[model samples]
Target chain A: MATTSEIQSNRDLFERVARRRRRQHAEQTVFTWLLRAAVLISILTTVGIVIILVSQSVGFFAEVSPWEFLTGTEWAPLFSPQKFGVLSLVGGTLLVAVIAGLVSLTLGLGSAIFLSEYAPERLRRVLKPILEVLAGIPTVVYGYFALTFVTPILQNIFGHDQVIVFNALSAGLVMGLMIMPMVSTLSEDAMVAVPRSLRDAAYALGATRFEVSTKVVIPAALSGIVASFILGVSRAIGETMIVKIAAGATPNLTLNPLESIQAMTAYIVQVSLGETPQGSLEYKTIFAVGLLLFVMTLAMNIVGRWVISRFRQQYE
Target chain B: MNKQESIINKRQKLHAIRVLRDRIFVVGFALAVVVGILGLAALLFDVLIDGLPFLNINFLSSYASRKAENSGILAPLAGTIWIVGMTALLTIPIGVGTAIYLEEFASKNRFNRLIELNIANLAGVPSVIYGLLGLAVFVQFLFNGSRSVTAGALTMTLLILPIVVIASQEAMKAVPSSYRDAAYAMGANRWQVVKAVVLPQALPGMMSGIILALSRAIGESAPILIISSLVWVTFIPTSPDSKFTVLPLQIFTWVSQPQHSFRGIAAAAIIVLLIVLLSMNGIAIWIRSKYQSRPDQ
Candidate 1:
């Protein structure tokens, strides 16, 4: 029923709208793909790290047998008769990690409980960020503190003859301090998540505040607390600078916290700092050690995440 | 009568013990908080005492020298700025894009789930291991063993990528869903909805996250140390490919020196690094609080 001119104008307008719609569709498609490529890059990084560690480690294991590398108690890859025994380094790593574990668990859990149960809201609000600053301090600075400050304090206490200048005690203690905030924050989050109903019920039963916190809130958040501790220990195991600068480089297979010892990460730094060439076996040892360190930490992280996720599923 | 009196006495004793234990625990917990704050205060005080004498304008302007007294942080300071700048440039786009895809566009599937898990795991990996990855991939394979600033930046980009993605994702998730629904109802396309509704609302949060992540990159030294290992760099990095040294690495070098004077210089460098880091953190915290307290939020 329309006139020819009117019909022709209508057709033109319809075509223009269609074209614009097509253009928009095209833009959406392009952006989706572009963003997808970014996601792929992240996946590629993990792949690249694994491939690099494994390939370089292959070169290392080609010359040094896995059994000897695993079983040997001495780790002197830079010196003559280069011992491939990784246990010595592992021992040092575990010794420091264990000491760090004790310190962090006590201090971190103690602070978490205080923040969650004891401190008034006003005090807690101010204290939490200040506490988080501890974690924000660089590990290198912690190393310096360990060397110049904590070492002197330890030397004075343990006697200069007993605690060597580069003993594991100071390094372990400071490393514990470094990781404390992580445990405190994560555990505090979990404890905070405990329902008010639970605390109220405990109070209704005439429990003290400390009793309520320890028996109710802590148990309720135990999985998350445990996970934080595991993650903290994993961090301690992989820590490099504190051990590298404060703990001695000698790979001693001893549990004594007062003696000098070399950690796996420290040894890797030692080699990297030296004039080791790219293709040499000394250069390759770092990769091999890195693979071990990666595996250990990755396993702990997985366990930690698994535990926390399980806890989350229960509540959420 | 005797048994009832004994029971009453026992109940009173138990109550007294519980009250005593509660008071003791309060003191103990308060001490824990004190120790944490004291540790930070002591570290700052120690650095101030040792480094203050050397923290003059001359220390900021001069270059590293063989003599401890003549040494300064000019080269490393410039290098830190360059590396952190490049890292931010490379990281923001990729990290935000990935976060958007996962949060908004991607279908919930096994592959996407794996990507999420992978990112979380990567977050837990040690900084030193990232140094190894950088040494192998960027430094050796990509750059052909050239320890350039670009290579260091790329390595850092990967190292901090997980953190940025996670933070950005959290920011995106914090955006309320009603905003998206309204846009869609108004005949907006997916990308249009994101551009018009989501991004503007999420920008402040993302800014805060990015600032915090970049602060981390600034303080990080292990990856840079492995990537360059050229501590005696007396000149500022003039280009991306110029061999560079960062403040942390310079501090590490000075700390390792046998001479006692180097410790003071190292402490001076630490003071500089701490000031930069603390200010960045303050800005991020400010942004976060500002955004959180908005009327709309």
Candidate 2:
């Protein structure tokens, strides 16, 4: 039954198919490696950021003690008799962030509640995209608005003598407005995810609309809402351009919202804008401050993400 | 009978109070929505009032001058184009590839989980921190202190990489598993199945996402400002290595001027920037709407 030529031809066919499969396997491996390399780039970016920040900060700390940098009440790295107390900068950053947090949380949660529970379907459809547009406007534009428009309005309200043109209130308020949509959208998504059956159960218990929304939906979505607020505050803390433009450059330790104060981000921008030579103490100050800023944001983000994941498991 | 009447009266009062509370909430929440709408309206109106008069062809074509009247956005506009274009070219391939690796090829292992977590963290990192990273790594280390367009684009690519990867992964995930199964069952290899089935289905989504990411890049200025601080750029960027200034930076520069005239031009630049962003968003929305209703799906 096995002729010699026929057997040879069968062998040739098998070899050809095997070769093609082998080639394809090789190609697949190559492609996968290429993609893996791409993934490595992102990993490298994080590593690179950490390394650069740490290394430059090492140079900075070699000259200035970490204790003085953290607990000292003044931040005048650019002036004569350089004081590296970072608390003043931290104070300014927190003051603005706190003001922004209050505004965004109130407006953002209110809007989210309205969008999820109160607005008609048609109105919600129109309103959500409009709200999202607020998030997309450049922060620089917000900076401009804060400086030119909002500052004058603040002056009108509080009197020109009380409200300096570069007061923290204007910057904080506009920055709050900038981040409000982020909270609204995320909170709305969480609210919308709350089961309809829960709302119906509340209705069956003779709960009013307000009762149902506050007692049922909001409670169900509370963790997600809190996560959104934390992330919003994180955003407010890291915001630069608006504060750089509207908030004054003086790194005051005072809690007064009407005074000129410099945020941490604004301080970095100020140093960068000036001709601080590379590899100098002044230049290294930005990285040290950046490292601090990064750590703060990273902590909040991790907590926010953890909260979201923990609560998300409930519905899932 | 008197006690029953009093109970009934109390029930009616409770219901009335609940109704009033509901009404109050509705009005209050409606006002919150109004605040968002009114804020956007006010911003647009303010910018238009200050900017519309200055938006002319001459303003678009001229370079910056000491006099605000003669200053133009020619250099910065061209620079923005160069930066955005180069950023797209660099980001798309790497971003898409990373998504494919994580979503398609990678096993559900610790490394992949770490990658995902890292990306999430990166997304939360402030834009300014990224600027510091860019200034140190790209401008100083890679480019040897040259604030070139490539440096800026590379920085922007890294800035938006997390967004693009997340988006592309979402797009790829949206592709029906049945398509991949059919292709695989037909003796197509993994790469072949992905190329012929998944990519075609995910292309439109990925495109729209990438467009939106690019729009974000266009609006971002902090990293660019850090990378290239040359504000009074007169010549258009002719190469990847040319020093550049972007529209946001130019607007910032103008707005910082002590003179009132510069503020007018800054508003004009803002209008141009907003129009560009709106058009990009329109295209993204159009792509999403057009391709979302496929016959096969």
lDDT of 2 by residue, A270-312 (tens): 8888899998999999999999999999999999989999877
The residue-by-residue lDDT of candidate 1 on A1-316, one tens digit each, is 9999999999999999999999999999999999999999899999988999999999999999999999999888888988999999999999999888888888899999999898899999999999889888888899999999999999999899999989899999988888888999899989989998889999999999999989999999998899999999999999988998999989999978999999999998888888998899999999999999999999999999899988762544
Residue B53 displacement (Å), model 2: 0.7
Candidate 1: count the clashes: 0
Off by over 4 Å in 2: A1-13, A313-316, B294-297
The numbered model that scores best in DockQ is 1
* Tens-digit per-residue lDDT, B1-297, candidate 1: 999999999999999999999999999988888888898898999899999998898899999999988988999999999999999999999999999999999899998999999999999899999999999998888899899999999999998899999999999998999999999998889999888889899998899999988988988888888998897888988999899999999999999998889999999999999999999999999999988877775
Task: Kindly report the docking quality category of candidate 1.
Answer: high
TM-score of chain A of each: 0.97, 0.95
TM-score of chain A of 2: 0.95
lDDT of 2 by residue, B1-297 (tens): 999999999999999999999999988888888887898898999899999998999999999999988889999999999999999999999999999989888899998999999998998899998899889988888889999999999999999999999999999999989989998999998888877888888999999999999999999988888999888999999999999999999999998888888999999999999999988988998899899898887
Looking at model 1 chain B, report the run of 10 residues with the lowest lDDT sum.
B288-297
DockQ of each: 0.81, 0.80
